[model samples]
Target: MSIQIGDTIPEVTLKHIHDGVRVIDTPTVFSGKNVVMFAVPGAFTPTCSEHHLPGFVARFDDFRSRGVDVVCIAVNDPFVLQAWGESVGVPPGLQMLADGNADFVRALGLEMDASAYGMGTRARRFALYAEDGVVRHLFVEAPGEFKVSSADNVLAHLD
Candidate 1:
């Protein structure tokens, strides 16, 4: 079964670019934090690049003021995630996490097969709000749909 509200985020190592490519486990990232993590199928794809990421970029402060840390994850390398964040002007402090091997998504049961599109294993578009590593809310988009997982939608529900 997929992870749900009240479930603890699974432990897995994920990569991100900071001073260098750093590998951090999920427990370390989510522990003691009010976190909003949103995942995309892949980086640089149209909807992901144009809409999904930008919405979070635009609302980064809204989340921060509420004492929440915002994260964006994709099944791409740390290098690509870094470059994409720079290209889109992602403000500092918004984490760009690389679920490079799809381990994290599979653990959450959110992995989707995009092989038909030649993208191989990918994450479904979804977002979750967690407090101290325990999920409080989850918003998963329907196939080919983008609505509930948007930054605005998540914040609305959070409030």
Candidate 2:
């Protein structure tokens, strides 16, 4: 079943790029913390590259002040995520985590097959407020839609 509000995140290792090296199995990175994790279809896609990521980057300070740590996840590799974060001007306090194997996505039951689009498996656009590793709020978007999971919407929920 899809992870809903009140569901705790599973213990799954996700990869990330740090100092030009690919680091793997970093599941406890968010442990014991209040985090806002949002997943996108893929990295460098139009909507995701332009609005979705920049929105979070722009409002990162607000999220931090609200005591919410923000992270962006995609099915791409860590290199792509790192480059994308640089290209999009990702701000401080926001992490670009790479769920390249889709383990975490499957754990959350948010995995989607984009094989028809030549993308293979990827994550749907959604945002979750996790307090100390347990979900407090979830905003999942309809297929091909980008409404509720927007940074503004998540901010409203934080308010």
On lDDT, the candidate that comes out on top is 1
Q: Ten-residue segment with the worst summed lDDT in candidate 1?
A: 20-29
Local accuracy of candidate 1 as per-residue lDDT tens digits, 29-92? 8999999999999889999999999999999999999999999999999999999999999999
- TM-score for each model: 0.99, 0.95
lDDT of each: 0.96, 0.88
Per-residue CA lDDT of model 2 for 1-159, tens digit only, reads 999887778888777777776564434656778888999999999999988999999889999998888999999998999899999999866889999899889999999999999999999999999887789999999999999999999999888
Backbone clashes in candidate 2 total 0
Off by over 4 Å in 2: 22-27
Error of 2 at 133 (Å): 0.5
Backbone Cα, N, C clashes tallied per candidate? 0, 0
